[model samples]
Target: MAFSADELRVLRRALATALNPAPLQGEDVQDCLRLAEAVDDAVREAGRLRAFLLADLARYREALPGSLPGYLELLQDALAAGYDPAVDDLAALRALRANPRAAVLLDRCQVLAERSVRARLARVTQTAVATTPRPRVRLLALPGGRAADEPKPTPAPPPAERPVPKPSEVFPPRRRPVPPPPPEERAAG
Candidate 1:
């Protein structure tokens, strides 16, 4: 989010005081509080605006081909705000494919739908993995328990311990190998 100059100034002063451990003036504290409230208000307004936009989109979707303009506008705005298109939106776009814009939107929405599904699947996989019991990792030595099942990460050997990779292996080959200079040229050389 872009911060205004005033907000940025307040933020800078607050951070400076935080790091330097200097006592803040009453006015500085007030400014920081005001900035926090402004940030909270902006967040709330964003949520409300998104909710309203979603409601309007649903209404327009129900109105079908008749409210195409408003539907498309709201859908585009929602998409810009990271709203995942619903199945209904996909269906509506497909049905309205006679409109060139709707056809294009259908393609875009299809891509978004696939991405959303993949994200959801990834989340579910992560959640499943997280929920399955893992050996508790302890930072400090546990009093009497067995060590964690996960092996401790081994530290990398010092630079001198192993030979460094050649530059070609470290970096990708920048150019394709010259074609063997042809068999006749090789023999001549």
Candidate 2:
């Protein structure tokens, strides 16, 4: 992503053109358009790579304690890449928390998850305010003022009818006690 001096000069000229229209050679305009397209392509490629990384991480997680080493490595790489931890990721880390690395990642992932959730809630709030219809309140006038009959305003739905879940409900306790596979079946398994 490092830009050469020539590219920097072109970028500066392009930005100046944006602020104030000026006659420019066709070559300069073409360069700016090409740069913009290149940036867009880079963004799309990054998104695809991130999606692949997340799917691979999920696969590794499903493999459980056996995939511990790879999963931890991938998780750290993902965190560095600004990946937000989903519930499954948090659960996986919690299950593996006995490993010191997993414990640290669990704490990190929890913070990332909380921040991601808060960001989403904020976006939803903004969208709701911008797009949701406001309930119309009917006004009734006293005898001194002129009044006209109007339909009653519909009530707003009860806010968030479902209760917020407790932490335990969101993240259940770790592994259940299960008898190890009987010796007779271990080899077959």
What lDDT does the true structure give each of the candidates? 0.92, 0.90
Tell me the tens digit of each residue's lDDT in model 2 across 1-189. 677787788899999998999998999989998888877888899899999999999999999889999999999999999989889999999998999999999999999999999999999999989998889999866654333355557899888878889999999989979988889899887
**Cα lDDT of model 1 by residue, 1-189, tens digit:** 679999999999999988899888899999999999999999999899989999989999999888999899899999999999999999999999999999999999999999999999999999999999989877778644555766678998777667779998899878867666788988999
Instruction: Name the candidate that leads on lDDT.
Output: 1
RMSD values for the candidates in order, in angstroms, are: 20.2, 21.6
Instruction: Give all TM-scores, in the order shown.
Output: 0.67, 0.66
- The collision pairs in model 1 are none
Deviation (Å) of 106 in candidate 2: 0.3
Least accurate 10 contiguous residues by lDDT in model 2: 143-152
